[model samples]
Target: MENRRGYSVYQIALHWLIAVFVLFQLFFGESMTTVVDAVENGQPVSTTDQALGSAHYWAGLAILALVLLRLVLRLASGATASANRGPRWMQLAAHALHGLFYMLLLATPVAGLLAFYVGDPWGDIHSLAKPALIVLIAAHALAALYHQFWLRDGTLKRMLSPAG
Candidate 1:
């Protein structure tokens, strides 16, 4: 088997960290939305739900910081080159997908922050950011699935294993 280029330690760390944050944001953000809906419909918000909402809010802020750091690390390290063994169209698609990933990743959290500031009344700051995050997450997930299943080009593996 051929050895692939592994991602730098910093890149690996950032990737995993962001993955965790994104996953957490997805779950917790949805939970907060449910809580808000329940309250609006004259249902009581459970203590556990309230706590989760608060946690999500604080976590979102932390995610913002980590994202900024990741962006800086990305700029300093430069981006990985696309795997060279694909068809021209596949290669182009991979590049476009990656570009979209970065754009959505950056935009999602920023939009969430903006939504928070714009008076979303969930009282849980993170819940307010869900609308934007949902769009980004959907985009990110679809792109990943496309590369992994449709393209079968190992673009996902590149990040999962190491950079080449």
Candidate 2:
């Protein structure tokens, strides 16, 4: 496969890094909610568990920062070849989905931070952001699957493995 124009090595690295962080955030988030519920129910909560939850929350914020950086890079670099070459409707859909992803990705963390500020008594209210993140993730995943399985347009390959 030929390397799609407009995606640099830095962009690729950023994409994969964000992917890992998002997935980790999802896993840690589900667990943290359980921990918070346990504590709320007057059950004993281990300090280690609390620490882990905090770690996940803070790490998610870090990922948010990276996402912002990636957005900047994407804006500066412009769209990939697949984006330019695709049908107008497909391109529009891709852009819309990507926009939604960015909006949710940014909003989720901010909501979590706000929830934390409101004094939820949990280590971090960021866990509350999980549902929103899950929704965005599902959309992102479904879009990818649709592109790969139904469209078969090589959009996923542009991110998964650039063509030489």
Candidate 3:
């Protein structure tokens, strides 16, 4: 892990791909729930919201595929051995949070699909995961900022720039 200091171009690309799509899904996915509630309440919902809801479904599936690809890349490319510069505790936390990210990224879509096809209970769990993921994302961003800005380290640059 100490020997490797940077990520390859493809690794950085996959990271950004998943990051962007997940954020997009977070922003748009809730509209689907709103539409569902409207329909359940026998209220007239607009076609746009309904369409957005459908888009959310497809977007979720896209996220699933991206996450899977990211995992495959992570495994095949030995991407995790970055020249991590931080306290041991922070490094461990980073790894743990990343592992959680993968789990939730994989599970959230299944929960969403199940909620869509099975019933509302799974939807409730998916709803709960949204906030948790949001928090994790916020923390992740802040950590990157901390490393780049405060610590004057190259952690953020590792993801943003290709390995030399």
Number of the top-ranking candidate, with lDDT as the measure: 3
Give the per-residue lDDT digits (tens) of candidate 1, residues 26-135. 77676666665786688988888888877766777777787788778767766666556557886676567656656666666666566555535324543444565566
lDDT by residue for model 3 over 1-28, one digit each (tens)?
Answer: 2344577888788788878878877888
RMSD, every candidate, angstroms: 5.4, 4.4, 1.8
What would the per-residue lDDT of candidate 2 be over residues 16-83, giving only the tens digit for each residue? 89888888877767655666577669987678678777886787798889889988877776766663
lDDT of 1: 0.67
Task: Measure candidate 2: CA RMSD.
Answer: 4.4
Off by over 4 Å in 3: 1-4
Q: Among these predicted structures, which one has the highest TM-score?
A: 3
Q: What clash count does candidate 1 reach?
A: 5
Note the clash tally of each candidate. Answer: 5, 4, 0
Note the Cα lDDT for every prediction shown: 0.67, 0.71, 0.84
